[model samples]
Target: MSYKIIVDGIQHKFSSAHFIVGHDKCGRLHGHNFHVAVEFGGPLDPRYNFVVDFIDVKNAIKAEVDKLDHRILIPTASKDLVLKESKDNLDFTFSGKRYSVPRDDVCLLPLPAVTSELLAKHFHDVLSQRFKGFKIKVRIGETSSTFAEYGE
Candidate 1:
């Protein structure tokens, strides 16, 4: 039989800023109180009788989200963005507008856009690698009511 362990709470959230490349209002720099939840699915280990320990999953999730907390999320793979890196700042231009943010306050993500949908997928890919024997699902909320999910 298959079982799933789900984790989500106040500790699983981060606040970050990002802008969509071609979006109208979203293209303007803004931030969100983003929340993340994860589900791990697989047969329970005979020894533990649980899919995995809650602390293990919690710690992994916290580590990932903590890196993004209170930072600007920059997408490195977007074809519409031009980036210039300096020792102190990341200068990026999108849709004819230029912005320079401090390197220390930014998290560079290997994604085309820093949307909730892609963020969920990025979490799924990373967490799945950490827990190989399970099917992973990631759900990310950009706001209290708006959410996006990824994984099988």
Candidate 2:
């Protein structure tokens, strides 16, 4: 039989700043109190009788989201952004504007954009690596009403 377990709540959330490229309203720097929810699916282990340990899943998701908490997310793979890195700071130009932020306050991501859809996929990829052999679904919410989901 197939089994599924979901993990979500106030703890699985992060607040970060990002901007969407080429858009009107979202093109400017904005922040979100982003929330994450994950679903794990597969046959239960014969010995444990559970899909996986709840503590393990929570810690893994928490670790990933904590990296972005209270930081500015920078997408390194964007062709429209010009990034210059220094020992203590990061300077980037996007949408004809320039910004210099402290290095400690930035979370560099290997993504083309920092949209909710890509963010969900990014979490899904990390969870997939940590929890192999199980189907994984990652859902990200920029707000209580808006969300994006990604998985196999």
lDDT of each: 0.92, 0.94
| Candidate 1 residue pairs in backbone clash | none
- lDDT tens digits, residue span 99-130, model 2: 99999999999999999999999999999999
Query: Which ten residues in a row are the worst by lDDT in model 2?
Result: 6-15
Clashes of 1: 0
The candidate that wins on lDDT is 2
Cα-lDDT of candidate 1: 0.92
Q: Give Cα distance to truth, residue 92, candidate 2, Å.
A: 0.4
Quote each prediction's TM-score. 0.97, 0.98
Per-residue CA lDDT of model 1 for 1-152, tens digit only, reads: 79998897456999999999999999999999999998889999899999988898998889999899999999999999999999999999999999998999999999999999999999999898888988889999988889999997
Please list the residue runs of candidate 1 whose C-alpha ends up more than 4 Å from where it truly belongs after superposition: none
Q: Please give the lDDT score at residue 19 for candidate 1.
A: 95
lDDT of 2 at 61: 92
Give the Cα-based TM-score of candidate 1 against the true structure: 0.97
